[model samples]
Target: CWLQQALRATDNPVIDAAVRLGNVLGLPVLVYHGVREDYPYASDRLHHFILGASRDLAAGCRARGLACVQHVDRSGHRERGLVYRLGADAAALVLEDQPTFVARWQTERVAERIEIPVYAVNGACLVPPAVLGEGIGGRSGFLRRHEPGRAAWTVADDESTDIAPYDGTLPFVPDTLEGDLDALIAELDIDHSLPASAAFPAGRAAAETRLMRLIQDVLPGYATTRNDATRREGASGLSPYLHFGVLGPREVMRAVEKAAVGARHSIKFADELLGWREWFHYQARALAKPEQYDRVAGWARATLADHAGDPRSHLESLTAMLRGETRDESWNACQRQFLRFGWMHNNLRMYWGKRIIAMTPDPETAWATACYLNDRLSLDGRDPATYGNIAAMFGGSPGDTDRPVYGRLATRSDGSTRSRDGGAAWLAKAAS
Candidate 1:
C-alpha cells in the first residue's frame, strides 16, 4: 500500500483495503510512505507534523503485523520516482484516493505513468464517494443520498491478514525515523522559519488526546460555545489530525456518538464534523480542480469583477498579512492562530476571509491571498473544507445589498466573538 495522506494504521480504509487485498492474493502487504521537499508549502510546520505522524504510522503498522517503509526527501536522501519504482516490485498498487491539493495531483500523475494496474480507495470520507453513486447534482440531492448511508459507514473496517508483513524490498533504502525528527527536518530544503505547532502535537497519541477533548470538553457545550471564539474549549482541535489522516472521521464520529453530551450538542457537533465537512469533500470530488479560483460561484465572480476597481484603504502587504502584522486587529488575531498554532477558529475565519476582499487590490488577489495564507500557514489548509469555506466567504448567497469592493458578495464581522465577555481582550492578546 502506498499512502499519500491517510497516515493512520487502523481504522484507515486505505490500509484496510490493502490488507484485504494482500490476504486474498496470499501475499504479505508492504506499505510505503514518502515525503518530498518539493510538495506545496513544504515547511518546518508541515514537515514536523507529517514526519512525526509517519513515525507513529510505522510503529502502528508494525503493531498490526505490517511492514511500513518511509523515505524523507532531502539533500542526501533524494530518490526519484520512488512510487513508480516500488510499484514495479509489487503484485499491484493500492493508494489513497485524495481529491484535493498536492496528494490528488501526485496520485493522478502516478496512475498515468505507472504500468501496474492501480486501485484507489477513499480514505478520507465516512461514506466513500463511489458508494454514494453517480448523478447527484447539488447538496440537497447529495444529502438525500448521503444522510441515509452514514449509519452503515460508522462501523470500523479493521481487516486482518493471515500473511506476514513483506520483508523483501528491492527499491532504495528507507529512512529510519526512530530518533531526532526535528534534527532530520532541520536539514531539509524546506522553509525552516514556520515552526511546528505547540498547540497540536503530532502522532497517534496527540490525536487520541484531541478526541478525548472533543468528547469530554468540547462536545458538552458545543452548540452554545461553538461560535464564541473566546474560549479555548469551544472548538475541537481535531482538524489538523483529521487533515493529515492521523484520525479518520469514522473513529472521530464513533467517539462523538458515545459522548455524554446533550442531544442538541451532539447533533450540532455532528453537523459540523460529519455533515458539513463530508459535504465539502463530496463537492470537491465533483469539481475538476477544486483549488482553482474558477471553482468559486460564477455569480460571486461576476459581482466581484464589477466592483474590482473599488478604492480600498489600509492595504496590507503579503508579508504583513503572512506575519500577522496586518492593520486589521481582528484579522491579525485570526492569522496569528494559523501562524502560531497552525489553526484558526471557524468563527474568526469568516471575518478574516471576508475582510481580505477590502484588504487586497482586487477580488482575485483576495482569493489568492486567502488560499495562500491558508495553504501555507494553517494545518487544515489545502483541504476540501478549507477551500469550500473560503469559497463560501467570497461568494455566499448573493446579498440584496450592493456594497463597495464586496459588491453582491456577503461581508462579515467579528461581532460573534468581539461582542462577548472578554472577547476584545482575547482578540488583542491573540493579535499580540
Candidate 2:
C-alpha cells in the first residue's frame, strides 16, 4: 500500500482496503510513504508536518502487525524509481484516490507503468466521490444525494491482516524517522525560510487534541462563532490535519456525534465539515482540471473580461502580498495568517480571495496569485476545497450593475472581520 496524503493507520480506507486485498491473496502488506524535495512548496513547514505524521504512521502500522517504510528525498538519500522498484515485489499496489496535486499525477503514472494490478481507494472523503456518481450540478443537488448516504458511510470497519509483516525488501534502505527528526529535516535541501507551524502540530496525538478541542470548545458555539475571525477558538483549526489525512472525516464526525452539544451547533458544524467540504471534493472530481482558470463560471469570466480595462488604482506587488505587507490592512491580516501559521480563518478567506482581483494586474493574474499564495503558504493548499472556494469567490451571482475590476461578480467586504468588537485592533496587530 502506497500512501501519499492518507497518512493515518486506523480508520483509513486506503490501509483497510489494502489489508482486505492482502488477506484475500494471503500476502503481507508493505506500506510505503516517500517525501521528495522537488514537489512544489517543499518547505520545512510541510516537510516537518508530513514526516511527523509518517513517523507515527510507521509506529501505528507496526502496532497493527503491518510493516510501513518511509524514504526522505535529499542529496545523499536520493532513491530514483523507488515506487517502481517496490512494485516489482508486490502482487498488487493500492493507493489513495486523490483528485488533485502530486498524489493524483503520481498514482496515475505509477498505474500506467507498473505491471501489477493497481487499485485506488477513496480515503480523503467520508462519502466517496465515486459513490455520488457524476453530473450533480450544485451543492443543493449534491446534498440531496450526499446527506442520505452519510449514515451508511460514517462507520469505518478497520480490516485486520492475518499475515505477518513483510520483511523481504530488496530496494534501498529506508530512513528512520523515530528520533531527532528536526535535525534530519534541517539537513535536507528544502526551503528553510518557512518554519513549522506551532498552532497545528504534527502526528496523531496533535490531531486528537484538535478533535477534543472541536468537541469541547468549537462545537458548542460553532453556529454563531464560526464566522468571527477575532476569536482564536472560533474555528476548529483542523483543516491541515484533515487535508493531510491525519484525521479522516469518519473519525472526526464520530467524535462530533458523541459530543454533548446542541443540535443546532452540531448540525452547523456538520454542514461545513461534510456538506461544504465534500461538495467541493465532488465538484473537483467532475472537472477535467480543477486548478485551471477556465474552471470559473462562464458568465463571471465574460463580465471580468468586459471590465478588464477599468482598473485605475490599488495594485500591490507580488512580494508585498507574499510577505503580508500589502497596503490593505484586512487583506494583509488574512495573508499573515498563512505566512505565520500556514492557515487562515474560513471567513477571512472569502475577503482575501475576492480582494486579490483589484490587487493584481489582471483577472487571470488574480486567480493565479490567489492560488499561488494559498497553495504555497497554507498547509491545506492544492486541495479541492481550496480551489473550489477560490472559484466561488471569483464567480458568484452577478451584481445589479457592473463594477470597476470585479465587474458582475459580487465583491466582498472586510466588515465580516472588521465590524466585531476590537476587530480593528486585531487586524492592525495581525498585519504587523
Candidate 3:
C-alpha cells in the first residue's frame, strides 16, 4: 500500500483494504510512504508534522503486524521513480483516495503507469464520495444522503493479516525517522523561512492529546464558543492532524460519540466534522481543480469582476498581507494566527478570506493570494475546507446590496468575536 495522506495505522480504510487484499492474496502488505522536496508548498512546517506522523505510523504498523517503509528525498538520498520500483515488487497497489492536491495528482499518475489493479480507498472521509454517487447539489442534499450512510461507516476497519510482515524489501534503503527529525528536515531543500508550527506538535501522541482535550475542555462549550475566536478552548485545533490523516474522521467521531457531553454540543461538532468537512471533500472529488479561482460561484465571480478595479485604500501588498501587517486590524488578528501557529480560527478564516478580495489588486489575484498564503503558511492549508471556505467568502449567496470591492458578496466583521466579554482583548493580543 502506497500512503500519501492517509498516515494513520489504526482506523484507516486504505490500510485495512490493503491488509484484506494482502490476506486474500496470501501476500504481506508493504506500506510505503515517501516524502519529496519538490511537492507544492514543501516547508519546514509540513515536513516536521509529516515526518513525525510517519515515525508513529511505522511504530503503529509494527504493533499491528504490517511492514511500513519510508524514504526521504534529499541530496544524499534521491531515489527517482521509487513508487514505480515499489509497484514492480508488489502484486497490486492500494493507496489513499485523496481528492485534491499532490496526493490526488500522484495517485492518478501512478494508477495510469502501473499495470496492476490499483484500488483507491477513501480514507480522508467518514463516508466516501464514491458511495454518495455523483451530482449531489449543495450541503442540504449532501447531508440528506450523507447522514443515513454515517452509521454504517462508524465501525473501525483494522483488519489483521495471518501472514507475517514483508521483510523482503528489495528496493532502496529506507530512512529511519527515529533519528533527529529537525536535523534531518534541515538537510532537505524546503522552505526554511516558514518555521515549524510550535503550537501544533506532530505524531500520534499529540493528536491523541488534542482528542482528549476536545472531550474534556472544548466539546462542552464548542457550539457556543466555536465562532468566538477569543477563547482558546472554542476550537479543537485538530485540523493539522486531520489534514495529514493523523486522525481520521471515524476515530474522531468515535471519541465524540462516547464523550459525556450534551447532544446539542456533540451534534454541532459532528455537523462541522462530518457534515461540512465531508461535503467539501465530496465537492472537491467532483471538481477537476477545487483550488482554482474558477470554482468560485458564477454570480460571485461576475460580481467580483464587476468591482475588481473599484478598490482604493484597502488594497495591500502581498508581503504585507503575507506578514499580517495590513491596516486591517481584524484581518491581521486572523492572519497572525496563521503566521505563528500555522493555523487560524475558522471564524477568522472567513473574514481573512473575504478581506483579501479588497486587499489585492483584482479578484484573480485575491483568489491566488488567499490560496497561496493559506497553502503556504497554514498547516491546514491546501485542504478541501480551505478552498470551500474561501469560495464561500468570494461568492456567498448574492447579498441584497452590493458594496465596494466585494460587490454582491456579503461582508463579515470581527465584531462577533470582539463583542464577546474578552474578545476585544483576545483580538488585540492575537494581532500584536
lDDT of 3 by residue, 207-264 (tens): 9999999999999988887887788798999899999999999999999999999999
The clash count of every prediction, one per candidate, is 0, 0, 0
Prediction 1 TM-score vs. true: 0.98
Which prediction has the highest lDDT against the true structure?
2
lDDT of 1 by residue, 310-338 (tens): 88886789999999998889999999999
**CA lDDT of each prediction against the hidden true structure:** 0.90, 0.92, 0.91
Q: Which is the winner by lDDT between candidate 1 and candidate 3?
A: 3
Q: Estimate each model's TM-score.
A: 0.98, 0.99, 0.99
Candidate 2 per-residue C-alpha lDDT over 125-193 given as tens digits, one digit per residue, 9 for 90 to 100: 999999988789889999999999999998768899779999985599998798898999999888999
Q: What would the TM-score be for candidate 2 when compared with the true structure?
A: 0.99
Q: Candidate 1, 176: how far from true, in Å?
A: 1.6
